[model samples]
Structures are given as C-alpha cells and as structure tokens.
Target: MGIMKDFKSFAMRGNVVDLAVAVVIGGAFGKIIASFVNDVLMPPIGLLLGGADFSNLKVVLKAGSEAILNGDAVVTPAVAEVAIKYGSFVNTVVDFTIVAFAIFMVIKAIEKTKKKEAAKPAAPPAPSKEEVLLSEIRDILKEKQ
Candidate 1:
C-alpha cells in the first residue's frame, strides 16, 4: 500500500506528467518531420540529384546465391542482400538537423522575450500608510531638533 501510494505520487508529479506529454508530442513531431523529409523535401532533392532515390541507395556487401535444382532453374531461394543504406541515414540526419534548429530557434525566441521583460523597469511599489506616518513623525522630530 505504501509503495502503491509512492508510485501514484511519483506518477502524478507535474514534471513527470510534463515529461510524458513531451515524449508523446516529440514522437508526433518526429513523425511529421520524417514525412516532410521523405515525402516533401526528398523528392525535389532526389530530382536535383539526377533522380537518385536515397532509400534505394546502398552498398551491397554480400550477394546471396541462387540455387539451381535438377540442372534447371526451378526455384530460387530468397537472396539475403547485405547493404549499408546511407541515403536513408542522410535523410534522418537532415531531419535531426531541422528539428534541432527549430528547437534552438524556439528557445532563442523564449530567451529573447525573457530578456526584454527583464530589461523593462518595473514600477516602484506604493509605500504603506505606516511608512507615511513614520516619515511625518521623523520630519516633526527633525523640526523640533
């Protein structure tokens, strides 16, 4: 029961909830960025690169063998193609760069706003009635002296 209460308290913490929400939103944002990169951005870039498809780009390391049965090509087994897909990696890198830059810009704008707010002079607070009475008393005492 104590452990359960502790778990509940931990789960209900503001930071924990905020982090969970951030994780969910971040996942969605990543998906949107990936779609933008793969669907929207990559198509034009691929065209500019002489119709090169990044996803299909790879370096074949091992070419799988085709089996020949009974001196005739009866059934060929599936060939395991080992390759490094750098084009997809490049796309992912671009996505990461864009996301990072966007986050940086957001943070920068927030910091700039904060600085502007801090730089503005705040109005002085009004003095209390007790402070006004004390000043009057002090002035009377000074006159008597």
Candidate 2:
C-alpha cells in the first residue's frame, strides 16, 4: 500500500511524464532520421561514388562449407547461405550520425534556452533595518579597532 502510493506519486510527477514523452518522441525521431539517411541521403551519395548499393556491400568469408552443384565451382541460384554484411554497417553508421546530430542540436537548443532563462535577474529580497544597523555598527567597530 505505501509502496504503491509512492510509486503512483513518482509516476505522476511532471518530470517523469516529460521523460516518458521525450523517449517516445526521440524513438520516432530516430526512425525518421534513419529512413531519411537510408532512403534519401545515402542513395545520392552512393550514386555519386559510382552505383554502389550500401545494403549489398559485404565480404564473402569462407564461402561456407559443403558446396552444392556436386563438385562444381559455380554456385546455383537457389541455395541457403550466410554472408558478412558490411553494407548494413555503413547504413547503420549513417543512421547513427544523423540521429546523433539531431540529438546534439536539441541539447544545444535546450542549453541555450536554459542560459537565457538563467540570465534574467531574480527578485532581490528586502533588507531588514536590524541588518543595516548591524552593518553600520561593524563599520564603526572596524574604524575604531
């Protein structure tokens, strides 16, 4: 009961809710960035660097055991296989870069806003007459001693 109530209160806090929302939005933003990189940005870049598809980029390591075609060098069209896909790595790198840049910009904007907010002067507290008298007495004592 006590634990449940505490959990409820914590979950209902504004910061926690804001964080949950941010996580969801950030995930969606990452997907959008990944799609933009794979679908838009990479295509043109790949074309410019000669028509090389990043998705098909890979290293054929070992070429797998047990070759089919009954002692033939040529591999047939239909065959179960495994390949080291380095092209996917390139795509992932691009996606990471885009998402990282987006997150960096968001953090930079948030910091800028925080700095602007911090620059505003807070209201000064009213001083009491007793404090003023104490200061004056201290000054007089300093002058004398």
Candidate 3:
C-alpha cells in the first residue's frame, strides 16, 4: 500500500503529467504531419516529377517469383518481393523536417516572449526608512519657514 501510494504520487506529479500530455499531443501532431506529407505535399511533387508515387518507389534487390507447382500441387510457396522503399523514406524525412521546424518556431516564440518580459522595467523599489525620515524632517522645516 505504501509503494502504491508512492507510485501514485510520482505519477501524478506536475512534470510527469505534463510529460504524458506532451507525448499524446506529439503522437497526434506526428500523425497530422505525416498526413500532410503523404496526402497533400507528395501529390503535387509527384506530379511535378512525372507522376512518380513516393510510397511505391523502391529498388528491387531480388526479383520475386510466383509459386512453383506441379498439377496444382504446390512444390514451392510464393516468394515476396524484397526492395528498398526509398519513397516512404523520403516522405518520413520531410515529416521530420517539418516537425523540427515547428518545434524550433515554438521555442523561438517562447524565447521572444521571455525576452519581452525581461525587457520591461521592474517597478522601482520602495524608499528606505532613512529616506522617509529625512523627507518628514524636511517637510517639518518647510512648515516652520
């Protein structure tokens, strides 16, 4: 029970909770970026590059063959094509670039706000006791005059 309570406390800490929220939001943001890269960005780029589909782009390392059979009895199973899918890699790189740029912009904006806050002049400090006493004595002398 003590261990459970400790675990709960650790998990419910502000930093821990904030980290969890960040992970969830980061996952969703990644999906949105991937969709933008795959659906919106790639199509126009593909069209410009002579209708080449990036996802389907690959270099066949070994040519695959159909199942070998004798009298409809399979002697060998169907072999799958093995290839380097570089188009998917390209899309992934683009997604990473966009995400990095977005995080950079967010950091820049945060820093800008921090600088603005720091640049504002602080409120002047309250007068010391001696200054207050001095001012009161000066006012008393003025009254006498």
Candidate 4:
C-alpha cells in the first residue's frame, strides 16, 4: 500500500507528468517527421535524383537461397538475404537531423523568451501608509533634535 501510494505520488508529480506528455508528443512528432520524410520529402528528392528510390537501395552481401523439400525430406534450408540498407539509414539520419533542429529551435525560442522576461526591470513596490507616516514622524523628530 505504501509503495502504491508512493508510486501514485511520483506519477502525479508535475515533472513526471510533463515528461510523460513530452514522450507522447515526441512520439507523435517523430511519426509526423517520418511521414514527411518518406512521403513528401523523399519523392521530390528521388525525382531530382532521376527517380531513384532510397528505401530499395541496398548492397546485397549474400544471395538468399530457397529451401528444397522432397517427400518430407529437406535438402536445403531457406536462407535470408543479408544487405547493407544505407538508404534507410540516410532517411533516418535526415529525420533525426530535422527533429534535432526543431528541438533546438524550440529551446532557443524558449530561452529567448526567458531572457526577454528577465531583462525587463520589475516595478518597485509602493510603501505602505504606515511606513509613510513613520518616515514623516522621523523627519519631524530629526528637525526637533
């Protein structure tokens, strides 16, 4: 029960909740970026590159083999193809770059806002009526002395 209560309190903390929200939003943002890269950005780039598809680009390291089965006897097993998928890596790198730039811009904007707020001078507080009266009395006392 105590552990449950502790967990509830921890989960309900402002920073923890904010982090969870950030994680969810970040995931959505990543998906949007991925869609943008794959659907929108890649097509134009591919067209510019003479209609080359990045996803399909790979270096076949080893050729795949088909399995041969005859009369419930397997002669050879099916082997999967091994390749270096550099095109997908490129797409991922681009996605990461865009996300990093976006986050950097957001942080920069936030910092700029904070700096602006901090740069403005705060207005001085007004003295209370009692303080004013006390000052006047003190002045009178000083003049008498």
- Clashing pairs for model 2 are none
Model 1: per-residue Cα lDDT over 1-145, one tens digit each: 9999999999999999999999999999999999999999999999999999887888889977766565665676667778888998999899999899988998999999999999999999998999999999999999999
Instruction: For candidate 4, give the lDDT.
Output: 0.95
lDDT of 3 by residue, 16-105 (tens): 999999999999999999999999999999999999999999999988889999998999898999999999999999999999999999
lDDT: which is higher, 1 or 2? 1
Write the residue-wise lDDT of candidate 2 on 63-129 in tens digits.
Answer: 6554446556647545445788999999999899878887899899999999999999988987799
CA RMSD (A), model 4: 3.5
Model 3 scores a TM of: 0.88
Q: What is the C-alpha local distance difference test score of each model?
A: 0.91, 0.87, 0.97, 0.95
Highest TM-score: which candidate? 3
Q: Which sections of candidate 2 miss by over 4 Å?
A: 1-7, 62-79, 123-145
Task: Write down the RMSD of all candidates, one decimal each.
Answer: 3.9, 8.4, 2.1, 3.5
Compare candidates 3 and 4 on lDDT and give the better one: 3
Clashes counted in candidate 2 amount to: 0
Output the lDDT of residue 131, model 2.
89
Ranking 2 against 4 by lDDT, winner: 4
Where is model 1 more than 4 Å wrong at Cα? Answer: 65-77, 134-145
Provide the lDDT at 37 for model 2.
86
lDDT of 4 at 65: 91
